[model samples]
Target: MKYIFLLLATIAGMLQLHAATVDTINVRSAQMNKDIKAVVISPENKKATSTLYLLHGYSGNYASWIKTAPHIEQLVDTYGYLVVCPDGGFNSWYWDTPKNNYLYESYITKELIPFIEQQYQVGSDRINRAITGLSMGGHGALYLAFRNQDLFAFAGSTSGGVDIRPFPDNWGMKTHLGEYHQEPKTWDAHTVIELTHLVKPKSLELFIDCGTEDFFFEVNNKLHEKLTYMNIAHHYLTMPGKHNGEYWARSIDFQMAFFAQCFQKVTLN
Candidate 1:
């Protein structure tokens, strides 16, 4: 009995040791003058070559991705990369507010990326970095990457409010960008669809998808059409699902695969 117990314990210990580890880290942001919480998932292999920054949707914190899509840890292990899920604040839209002090745009691009590269053993180049998110975060991932092409090599969005100008009353956009009635131009300028012209051809690899029944499906389709019109290459898909966990959980798998392919291509080059 004693020997059997010892063998079982050894196997359990080995399984635990081989599993990916999740760490909650507080990253300080001088721009926001606050310590943001981020969930870092490190694969069993310590020598991770790349990093993926996952942002959460509105009303979500650092734990959103792991809670909704727990299989991301498995992706970290299979892809052999570090995954960083940062808190973008509830309804911050990952934007730098002009009226408020929510400078999340600067916090992410300026502070968070630098902190991650310094703290982790991941590569520190555009080709080694990727970003993606769902809903508001989906918008944010594209917004940030489109503006800062030098930082992220690939970007994706799942059911993103990509065109915020359409829904001014929802998601506290009026508070973040001023009342739509009062600031129509501001709303237009901040939208991801409006900013597609900023992307240079083949400068950034992109993936966008949304559920057919999602409220944002029409907007996503419009954004896709606009991108196609502008000749910006991207992978877009419309699947049968809603704007809930069931959709996002399955959608992330596709996005991760897309990023994995991008990472592989970069490595081969």
Candidate 2:
């Protein structure tokens, strides 16, 4: 009985040693002129040197990812990578609004990335940086990665509103791009589907997945077709689920695995 008790205690200690650590941090964004809240998760052993930025969806905050999908903490432990979850602000669509003070695009690409690099011991180059998100964040990830290839080498989207022009009145997008009928050209320039031309062949790695039942399913499919027509290489998947925490939780597993493979390839080359 004594030996068994000692063994059980040893196992518990080992598990505790390998658990992931979570921190709630505030990163200053000069573009937005305010400190943004973010959740940073680091592996217990601190072996992972790469970083992955995870963005939340509409009506969600910085804590949404971990709160909705707690398994992400375990994922960090399994994959050994630092994960940073930043608040994109409700309905910000991760864009620098022309009519509003929401400069989320600048906050993410210019401010948040530099803050993460400075605060964490992760790689500073694009090869070591990746970004992905659910819903609205999904569009933001691809938009930022496609336009700023020098900052992120890998980008993924799960059930993302890739094309905002389709739903101008929904998700407060009209506030950012103005009325679609009033400024049709501005809407076209901002939509990810229209920005497919910005993506050069083999310029960056991409992963995209959406549920057949998701409201954004049609748009995701359209974006995939556009990428294919543009001759851009990307991994796209469709599964049986809707646009909710259940689907995103499962989808994130595959995305992190894909990112791990990309990181390995970068290290090998």
Candidate 3:
């Protein structure tokens, strides 16, 4: 009897996955020949407080988050909010650079956000929009949000390669910056940790989470320390996991819930 009950329970759980549907969108940018893919998930039964603009990591397409974090449906199945997962390219680092053809910053700020606002039930205010990502996309999320405060109110990064100067010669970033030695300023200016100096801190809510066992943990820790030195208030979290889908999928839930809560409206007379 117990054996039969366990088998039935496992079957029911697998069947539940069919209930949620992911709507994918592909947008081509004139800034680059490449096409951007995004997955938009909205719940119809309950009204949600805000929208979560998600970005993908290096070598990851927009499908990464949706495929890894299947539990996203349960988190807000009743709360009618928007979840958007946008591609940051194989590894563009979400930069609008002096040399690169892809101006992802412009595409997201000028094109994608407008499309979302125009096509969906999105609020125009910055408070209603939040951005976050992992690894390369984590760098992108902070870089975009910090540079364009008017577009995003809350920002978070998970295991972001925050300081890129160390890898100036490694990643294809040299092509984007035209050699680090030749354009040191560009490299310094674009790094997420280096760019932190430009942030106003209090103007936007921020969160950063990284696994102590992750390769990028040192840089992420440096970012947390620097932000603290600057007297910036942010949610800094450390967990015991590596750079993988299992951790990221779990982390996004907390990020989404926190960002959604920030966008909730309140009034007092």
Candidate 4:
């Protein structure tokens, strides 16, 4: 009994020692003129040289990922990559809106990325960086990654609102892009489904998945079809789940594994 107790204690201590460290950081966004809060998960050994920018859904903030999927901390330890969860702002849709103070597009690509690279031990190259999110963030991830292929080598979305034109009345997106009826052109330009043209062959690696029961399933499927039509290489998946935290909690594992494989390829070459 004494020896068994000692072994169990040793195992617990080892787990505690190697656990990832989670920090709440304030990144100042010059475009939005605010100090945005983000959850930064760092590996215990500080040996990670890559970073993953994870995003949240509509009305969710920086803490959303940490709160929804606590296992992400273990993921950091398992993958040995830093994870950053930035606040996209409520209903911002991660856009540099022509209407409101939601200049998130500029903030993320310009301010957030630079700040994280300088502050963390992460590499600045596209191969060492990836971006992904859930729902609104899913759209935001693909939108930003497609536009800035120089910044991210891997991009993914889980239950993303890829085509906002279908549900303009929802999510308060009108406050950012104006009503869909009035500014059809603007809506067409921002939606991820429309931006498939921007992606060049082999320019970026893509992973997209959604639950069949999710309301965003049709849009995600359409985006997948469109990407296939364009001959853009990607990984698309459909699993048994919904569009809630439970779904994302399960989906993030696959996405992280995908990114890890991509990162390894860079290291091998």
Candidate 5:
């Protein structure tokens, strides 16, 4: 009973890609002021075991992963978990703005997780919660997890822009942190790779992946190298590819699979 996921709606209009088996729900992110498209898929006639916050990268919406990686339904169906995709804002980079005063860190930590737990029957503890994202979001997931260790036990980033000093004009940094050269400390202080050593999370599982051909591979590599130097325990996987939806689409599988395995260990204990 395998079925393909859908992007554009046919006459049925946003129906299940797999014949009404997996539940696709479009919910609005009140903090972000946008509607998020999410999926809750479990084994047929069964409750979900775990939940994952599957974040998308820059210039992409919540539907990016579901559209590109049709196999996500396969992952959700097999693992019996809910995939939560929130709109991180187009090119928002998920950083808490200093001047503009939009606190994404607070929103995701204080609002979203609590709201999700209340609305859904999934386990509200760290064991049943995980976060992973690509590029901008990859950095975001790690930043959020490290800052709020109690909320998410497992976290990962793929082809993440861990270091942001290189791009002063790219993404939403200009609005978030002001000009890079003018406020160099502001930009450097918030970068995930730089802040890794500051976090002494009690119980957290961390992982990262990057493509050798990707433009941001160097930053991700620096993060891996630095984490190793700091003796922080994490899983780092480097493959050969560039920055594209396809690479992220495939990377999502690796991350979600890792999260699922970690959750299995947690449930056993």
Candidate 6:
């Protein structure tokens, strides 16, 4: 009898996992004049829930998150929220580049967001919205949230390249901002580390974590220190791992939980 019960329980769990709905949505970006693709994960419950904008790393597409961390489907159902994973473009750095045709920053904030709210049953308040990502997406998440605090109340980054000044030639950032030596001001304006001043004391809640051995660990530490000096409250974590899918998969669990708590508080209020 006990064995039969266990089998039925396992099947029930699998069925619940399959209940979450995943859709590929193409949002038209009027600014960039392109159809940006995104993966939207909606819970089976049709109740009005908050939205979490999840981003991908450098060179990854909208499908990256669902492909790497498939459990996010279950997490969405558990938290009773929607997850939107947007494509940041190949090495676009999620920036409104001056030299390139990529206007991701504008597209995400102005176009895609409005479309999502109009089409979905998610809440449209800052208290009901959040954003986070891995690596380049991490930097993009914080960068966007800091600049647009009215849009997202909670933000997080896992193994993010928060400081782009040090590794000027490493990523394809030069293509967006032009040569680092030639365009120092542009780099400074676009980097997340330099945007610390935009964050007020409690305006934006942040969760930042990086593997101790990750190359971006030092930058994440510097960001934490700067925020500390500014008296901005945030959560900082470091674990034994490297910058890879393994680290992101583990760290996302905590970030989603943090966002869930924030959303729950707003709901209770």
lDDT of 2 by residue, 1-269 (tens): 23323433453334443559999999888767789999999988666678999999999999999988887787787667899999999988888884688988899888888888888868998899999999999998998888888888899999999988778789888878789999999898877888888887787889999999999999999999988887899989899999899999888877877887778788889
- Which tens-of-lDDT digit does each residue in 1-269 have in candidate 4? 23323433453334444569999999887767779999999988757889999999998999999888898887777667899999998888888874587789899999999999999857989899999999999999999999999899999999999999999799998877888999999999999999999997899988898999999999999999989888999989899889899999888877877777778788889
- Supply the TM-score for candidate 3: 0.87
Worst 10 residues of 5 by lDDT: 1-10
Instruction: Give per-residue CA lDDT, model 1, range 1-269, as digits (tens).
Output: 23323433453234332567899999998877889999999988557889889989999999999999987787677667889999999999999995788999899999988898999867999999999999999999999999999999899999999999878899888987888889989898889999998898789999899999999999999999999999999889899999998999988878877787788788899
The digit string of per-residue lDDT tens for model 5 on 39-156 reads 5544454576577887778888767677767777766655567777776667767777745646667666766677667766788888888988888888889988877788888899
Please give the lDDT score at residue 177 for candidate 2. 78
Model 4, stretches more than 4 Å misplaced? Answer: 1-17
TM-score of decoy 2: 0.92
Q: How would you encode candidate 6's per-residue C-alpha lDDT over 1-269 as one tens digit per residue?
A: 23323433453354454557999989988777778899999988656479999999998999999888888887777668899999999898888874678888888889888889889957888898899999999999999999999898999999999999999898788877878999999899999999999987788878899999999999999999998988889888888889898888777777877787778789899
Clashing residue pairs found in predicted model 1: none
TM-score of each: 0.92, 0.92, 0.87, 0.93, 0.85, 0.92
lDDT of 6 at 9: 42
Please list the C-alpha lDDT of all candidates, in the order they appear: 0.88, 0.85, 0.77, 0.87, 0.74, 0.86
Q: Candidate 6, 262: how far from true, in Å? A: 0.6
User: Who is ahead in TM-score, 2 or 4?
Assistant: 4
Q: Give the TM-score of candidate 6.
A: 0.92
TM-score between model 1 and native: 0.92
lDDT of 4 at 243: 88
